[model samples]
Target: MTSTRTRLTPEQRRGQLLDLGVRLLATRPLDELSIDVLAEEAGISRGLLYHYFGNKHAFHEAVVRHAADDLIAQTAPPASGPPLERLLTSVTAYVDYVIANREGYLSLVRAAAGGNDRLREIYEEARAVLTDRVFREDPEGHILLDTPAARLLVRGWSALTEELVLTWADDPAGVTREELLDLIAGSLPAVAALAR
Candidate 1:
């Protein structure tokens, strides 16, 4: 049997490579991904992967960036709603995303904690974007709401949420999803208290 590969535009080709990288990263650690294997899977040569990304590190960064952007977009709440309602919606979406993308989530977390500085930066960037989105349109518009202390509190809460998701991913049966959502949602008051 014979197979044929379709020609793709530069942008389409790059996206295809990144999508493949994300899929592979989900099931395997970054270091385990290889140009040869990825190329073979994509029906291209190893040299072609480098042609698109320049090198492995660049490819990894691109994949990480794409994942971060996607996660942010996927979890963003509706533009208008009660703060608490919006928070719950966003948090639930986050939990669902983490559960659905366990390997991808774990790979990113492991990379960040395992001393991969670029991955860590990407992780931090994602957290910041989440924080900004959550606070960007607070209806209250109180002077203290967007203060530096408040911003830090949001960042800290986001870190805590990450840990919670990681733990929940390890043992879904240990805590019901409702309980997981409540735990993260319940922490908002404490976060607010700190900001005040």
Candidate 2:
């Protein structure tokens, strides 16, 4: 690959690399990402790429971490809102993000299910962060989700939401976004009741 040097500082260059990796994840599953291709896309040498990231696994880990941070930041709800409204806001943001970045979101799911331990950890961490945020504001303490039962319910709901969002993204004819949202929102009480 041809290399054209840029004047970006080390940290800026690393951030640029991470950004490119994120874009690449949008089109390819994590396991399929090619280091050579990444280096080429960045217009940098493989040696230079390794200088920034020790190896492909390191690169993947950085990308996963970056994606998780973005996912959480983009979907964060207003802290002052009513509990249900905040949850709806968060869920809506999540569904919107998945719809807008289907390939990337699916890549995360595929990585988690494909036995990539690091990716699985990052994915679960992201999910747990969101689940905790959404349930922490429960007015009736129905969805506080601190107990084992509540935690399990939240995890199940998260899985269900991911499946529904992916399915709807793949083929809207099966279910509209609003319908999917309704189903997700409707399940909250039942899930919360499991805690009680």
Candidate 3:
């Protein structure tokens, strides 16, 4: 049978492949998302995949970077709203993002912890962006984060939120989504206040 696949521009094809990688990542670790599998799914030869990404590691990095960017974009705070309301909005989006991308998020965390310097850097950069958002959106956060100790406390709070959200995603433990959001969003000031 003659192939009837539509031709895509180089950039379009590369983007299409990356999108597929991101979707597949939703269920498997980056390490297990082999080039062969991606090629088969894309209906392209492995050589063509390498032609686009140069190598497996490069492809993995591209997929991870896309995922991180998507997560950050999805969780961005509203440009204008009541401070507390904005925080809760972002937190709600974040919780929803992680729950929907649970396996992908977990795999990203595992990749960072697996001693890959580049992946770790990508993960840390995403965390830093999120931490900075908390400070930027919280009306009192600027004053609270004036000192080095205060900033550290906020970062710690970010970690706490991450752990709680991940745990809650796995098992709610009788906590309602609203309760979890309120707990995470409401605890920031108290956590940041420890620096005072």
For each candidate, what TM-score against the reference?
A: 0.88, 0.86, 0.89
Model 3 spans with C-alpha error above 4 angstroms = 1-7, 137-143
* lDDT by residue (tens digit), candidate 2, 84-107: 777778889999988776777888
> What is the lDDT for 34 in model 2?
68
How far in Å is the alpha carbon of 35 misplaced in model 3? 1.1
Please provide, for model 1 over 55-114, each residue's C-alpha lDDT reduced to its tens digit, 9 standing for 90 to 100.
Answer: 888887888888887789889987877777778899999998887777787778787887
Cα RMSD to the true fold for all candidates: 2.8, 3.8, 2.8
**RMSD of candidate 2 to true structure, Å:** 3.8
lDDT of 3 by residue, 130-165 (tens): 877756745453535456787788778888998999
Off by over 4 Å in 1: 1-6, 141-144
Which ten residues in a row are the worst by lDDT in model 3? 137-146
lDDT of 1: 0.82
The residue ranges of model 2 lying beyond 4 angstroms of the native Cα positions read 1-6, 138-145
The TM-score that candidate 3 achieves is: 0.89
Model 1 reaches what TM-score against the true structure? 0.88
Candidate 3 residue 129 Cα shift, in angstroms, is 0.8
